[model samples]
Target: MVAAVTGLGLGLAALGPGLAPGFVLSYDMVFVPDPAFTRMTFGLTGVVPRHVPSDAFVTALAAVIPADVVQKLVLLAVFVMACTSAASLVPSRRLLPRLATGVCYAWNPFVAERLLLGQWALLLGYAALPWVVAAAPRAHEPGGTRRLARALLPAAIGGFAALTVSALTAVTVALATRGERRPRVVRVVVTAGVLSLPWLVPGLLRPAGVPGDGTAVGLFAARADTPFGTLGSLLALGGVWNGETVPRSYGAPVTATIWLLVVVVALAAYWRWGQERRGAVIAAMVGFVVASLGAVSPGGLEAVIDLWPGFAVLRDGQQYVAPLAVVVAVGLGLAADRAAEARWPGVAAAAMAVPVFLLPTLAWGAAGDLRAVQYPDDWARARHIIDGDPAQGDVLVLPWASYRSYSWNHGRRVLDPLPRYLHRRVIVDDAVTVDGTTVAPEDPRAVRLAPAARTGAPPAVTLRDEGVRYVVVDAEPGTIRPSGAATAVLRGADLVVYRIDGAAEATGDQVPVAPVAAAWAVASLFVFWSFVAPRTTLSIPLLGSIKPRDPHRRRTP
Candidate 1:
């Protein structure tokens, strides 16, 4: 029933055409790779484990299906799960109210802008919010142990979804439990902490400073010039930092409509003021305030950014709007239920259609420009050529740029895809420096190659000295031009594999993969298994006997 409702709502919301069937290389979603490249790409992120789950998921899917198809399926699943989760949180059995909640949450402006921005991992985390919220109250219920254990599945899934959401979930759990239930909260926190070690361990073991510059904090901050602009955007769930991506069609009329709906839902919640609804209202308001603080209090946000460890990973504070989005969705459901009870069934029906009518541009892709693009045949051929070489040295990708503006990728700011394509270890210039502040590359070899690649000077001697066997020049015009004196072993339509003379014998400085990375990977598997494993199986024969049980405790049926 949930699937059917989600499919129907998404179809009505015009999500089909917007669903790209090929590579959508905007922003952070540019790390697509073939199945064989997954493990190598996994290590390329250095000791930081944040990209582990996303890389693993894509790699697992790529093993069976084409990577493009896998991406499309994953996106479709995100929409379905988001709608289903929101519907489950509605608490009402009425289909109209539940469907309204689903549509309001899944087809909002936030989802649209993020989809356009290509922040799939972040959106994946947003989709998990409703599930986490639904599971929170269960921690304090009768038979709360079993309930909390059940809740860990979603909590673990949320942790793997995005670090920010994981942290937020932990905070929510801590806040929800008090007095006698504090022990249950501790258990949940400990479980989440253990589950998060894959990414958390790497982040702690090798801490890199924040990615971008000071202006980044301001640019990505949530803006609120006016009450309507601030609260309306939050209510509509559309606090995207990039103004260019937002359509001009989303003008005052749409904003006013969204504001009206929000006002109606707010009044409904106030009128009822049930315990669960009161929590939702508080969470919604708090989320809005935090999200708005990024723009309103940039200085404060900057201080927090400097002080917080994992917090730096979340550049866009507008992502906190996710909690508000979930809250608003639940409110909409409740409002619809109230309207129906008041014998105004048509009002309930109208509320269901409000999101679709107000946020029209979000349908059929934001600004009507999101679609898939196939990679050139040369990319595959070049990968094959590079993989065929039995070399022991790293390959250097020219243009020496971390982000590429490729016409093939619709001029989106995407990370270079070469590192993920080639089987051989690669040395690509990933360091970015702005105003004396620099984010250094993981491999020092990348730093050394940057100067030569920048000057377009023949770096044959340097290549030999650094043990670089081959320089793979992406011969795309207007990018960096390679000038090394070398033998062109293979030349494709758009890429050239140059084998530097006298460098074949030089064993490059190979950075050893950290043993802790392997340990984290193995541990992550066990952690994931514990979440899915049966409770009976987890309680071992000897261990269960050794552990003391509460004699007065009543077993939950």
Candidate 2:
């Protein structure tokens, strides 16, 4: 009964329509204006502004889906995740691994964020992770070739699909699932490589950005130069990154506790379970440790340098905690089953692990008064203010929007002062310094102004001079304060609307007011579906139910 309920709940949460209440007020509220989502959405939808360089892959994907279809896709992704998470609860082996997996699966802000918040493709990749780890040596028998081929084929197909959707999670699976079988591993690798041919071919052929090939590393270095205390909260590098220039750090207190429990469990396994099961324990431990480091580097100097080459490719170090949680769970589960004598040892160890896992989540909640609902009213108002005059091409980008401090709030065509692919006109280009040293658009790649000027002053007087019709300042306090000149021009109002004289009749520069309407349409559809045509009665075939590919599992030993 528990298994059935959990499976149903997982299906509802991840696959949608039938099991449990879906993620209510998370990413759906916060993501529309996120920089990453917006950028991807714009490109994917082929909504490129005039003259911006866009990748063909991005454009083609978006062009195929209408706004309504995208909403359904989002819902479908949530359903799939819910189902997977629910199903995760059914495989109870022992307390320590179960608790760890349960906690990691249920919480872990990054996974929650992706699953409930935004980036549906990332969610899809995460859902496929269980299949990746569960792969095993083929059952030996007459006609084994057919059985193995059938079993391996779907797993390979699923994994390849996961990689294409979310390469980060795919990479995580690849690294964690290695060494089970050399020949099996080789086959998995070959299949994944072939499947990834599309993305690889394009990446290899793409032209280089300015400031050379190591741009990502250079950017990491610049950010790492700040004091540890500041970067600690901002980047969470305490776990993953280690560089000669940047001080080495460890996980947050919560993560530390979790790791401590993991170590204890592994040690217990080694002492009690004999040396044969040791390989699995050790492999799991290694994966969990490395995964944790990516979140917040365990070591300092060496790890940071190692990350620069290709490891930094996983930018959010915290993401590792998710898979690490899974590894720890599965490892400890095996350990709990294999333990020789004491039930209390496993129980006690698990008890210790729970508090550690909860601390980080509690700390995050304690940081501020977090309101459950993020009102989209503010964004709507901002969009309305900008769209009030469609003929005015002079919309100023907020500093936060340009710098990626938040999600996609501004439209793709707005003239943001920050550097983005939007390609709209800007008064202060991300490349130009307060004192006029160039970064990307110009050669020097350095900003030479005083830090205060860099933070406060406008990039140039170009916006006012360039016939900007309207200036926008995000109402987020303290970050993007208006300069004295900007205040004078605003006549002491909190938000000042300016009319750039003699600007050519601006076209295609306004923020559309359709977001609220679009959101409402989606809400209405869901409501109708919920009340009138409830999906509870609807039945969709499960992949497992439709076919049992692993029929020879009984003979695998």
Badly placed stretches (over 4 Å) of model 1 are: 7-21, 31-33, 37-40, 44-49, 140-161, 177-179, 207-215, 224-232, 251-274, 277-282, 429-445, 456-458, 490-493, 501-532, 537-557
Instruction: Tell me each candidate's TM-score.
Output: 0.83, 0.48
Tens-digit lDDT track of model 1 for 421-481: 7766667776644334455555445655677777755467788777777777764633443
User: Residue 98 error for model 2, in Å?
Assistant: 4.9
Cα lDDT for residue 332, candidate 1:
79
Best by the lDDT measure: 1
Clashing pairs in 1: none
Report the poorest 10 consecutive residues by lDDT, candidate 1: 537-546
Cα error, candidate 1, residue 328 (Å): 0.5
